[model samples]
Target: MNWRRLQAVMVKELRQMRRDRITLAMIVAIPVMQLLLFGYAINTNLRDLTAGIADQANTAGSRALVMDIVATTVVTPTLAAETPQQLMEAMRRGEISIGIVIPPDFERRRIEGRERVQILVDGSDNAVQSAAAQLAQMPLDAPVRTGPAIERAISVVAFYNPERRSAVNIVPGLIGVILTMTMVLFTGVAIVRERERGNMELLIATPVSSAELMIGKVLPYVAIGLVQTSVVLALGLWLFQVPLNGSVLHVYIAAMLLIVANLTLGLLISTRAQSQFQAMQMTFFIFLPSILLSGFMFPFAGMPRPVQWLAEVLPLTHFLRLIRGVMLRGASLWELWVDVLALLAFTVAMMTLAISRFRKRLD
Candidate 1:
């Protein structure tokens, strides 16, 4: 074992990391930024959302109920549509998520003891729909008295994510983001560092193989990525109350594959880039698409069709599916075979591309 040479390379890499102001900032600054921004800026619950109100009743009781609905912090009456047709058009055009309609016969129906107060809602906006549904269940003026029970012995429970907290969905995806930022950025800098310090030439002159060198460079980051995942899991569990209902080993296995794929991607990027600055820019360029398309901040279903299609190309998309399904849905490997297979394919492709790009002979 050439212990001195290995030690020299390791020390040199560490010194470079410490000396590079941008790298230091990224290592420290990015996480804090993400944590703070995500904590405060990102909210799953809909609040003060606009609703078009069409009140054909125009009666004292109906107006009072409408005013009460607008008074709540969750909803605010915006544009007043003359009819349901106009309100539906507004919802389709993304102008409003919710619309309340009081029919001309609203007071008549209530007087006659008929249940016909219609509430039109756009189910397409899942968050707004959920918030709107809860508001619908609330009676502003008085509860309607039904003559008889429509059914009995029925219990409806929302499954998978019962609380329907967006954090439950977002936390799993954050694991991928952490692994991506750490593994890819570190590995990119590591490979570029070897060449920048003339270590690559020295290594090529020795008996150490390219395969061995690649393995060595990749292992440290893989280990670090695992540590990060563990840290994130702990924080999520204790602070955010995200549950771990599935196999821990399964989470780790999927995580390892994702780390390897990201490391390989970093190595490939480093090989193409001339400097660490370029590598960092390249990483962000990729990171934007990864974060946006992987369904981290928004549901993939809610995104435009073009954006949804773009997200399909990211490895994080599949990994997120595996992690969220396993953790939140308690899905087994058999149920997530497709995602596992996709990740495996991604790992192989990325690693192959990286190894092919790596030059054994210094030039």
Candidate 2:
């Protein structure tokens, strides 16, 4: 309660903060970054969703219907699929968000006064699904009227997550979010704690190289990551009844790659941080963006193009795709190779950077 003592303590803390550039930068950068990310990147209004068209009708009426959907701007029909199966396959691979299947009888149905077309949406993303449904409900003007009494309507069907259950979509994504949070937090503190305890010098005095030391520290966490992934997957299946349609092995492989990437990123952060607290702060700096910008909460396509590009570089983004593809869509390895390769590249790059930055002797 002494005024002079409180003033002295406050001044001491201010001086300490001034000396830690990383902490100071974080204090200033975090709020500004959050404002920009949430303001510019996060959007609920879905637009330009990649659409696949399976025009089995192959008639003028079907073509006109496709154009009408495109004009709505809710879905862009960029892909032409030869069959309904092909359109569904594109959705499974996350190549397109909407699929329009014009049956061969579509024109005939219109002529007979019972015209209906199917609009399949990737319901894994609830926002996109809702928007697509609204767009589909909008009445379309028939290009060729076979009869004055005939009516045209579009039926919206949700695939992969028919009921539009939030758990069905969110639980698989939680796998990536959980891995990113735990892997980064655990490994971020490891090396800094060792250095703080003066064990780093002892290790350096030994013959172990920097890469060997880094890998040694990271190897144990890989097992921990696998255990965490399995537990989450089991709970999601049991509690949420989330389907695991693809091979479990593919999910395991993708989880392993994602874990390694995040762990290596943690190691890199630990090398830069002078204390465990700084390591934790750096982890938060990475964590916030990973969760917000990585399509965990918001649809990736809904974000601005630059933010979408940023999401593409985050490990969580690719892992989400992999987990969702395997769990919901039953996508095979070949279909998810792009995401796998992205995770692999990130892991290797982060591993190399962490080793190169790790010093044999403590500063």
Best by TM-score: 2
Name the TM-score of candidate 1: 0.59
What TM-score, computed on C-alpha atoms, does each candidate reach?
0.59, 0.94
Worst 10 residues of 2 by lDDT: 142-151
lDDT of 1 at 316: 89
lDDT of each: 0.70, 0.86
Candidate 1: residue 52 Cα off by (Å): 31
Question: How well does candidate 1 score on lDDT at residue 145?
Answer: 32
Residues 199-221, candidate 2: write the lDDT tens digits. Answer: 88889889999899889988999
Summarize candidate 1's per-residue lDDT along 1-363 as a digit string, tens digits: 899999999999999888865567667766765564355434555567767888888987667656666655556677798898887666544456577777887666656656434556644334554666666555444332322111111111233454567777668878998887778889878778887898888888888766678778898888889999999999999988987868899899889988988888888888777677868767876786687557576544444445556667677887877786668656566667776887788777877777778887655
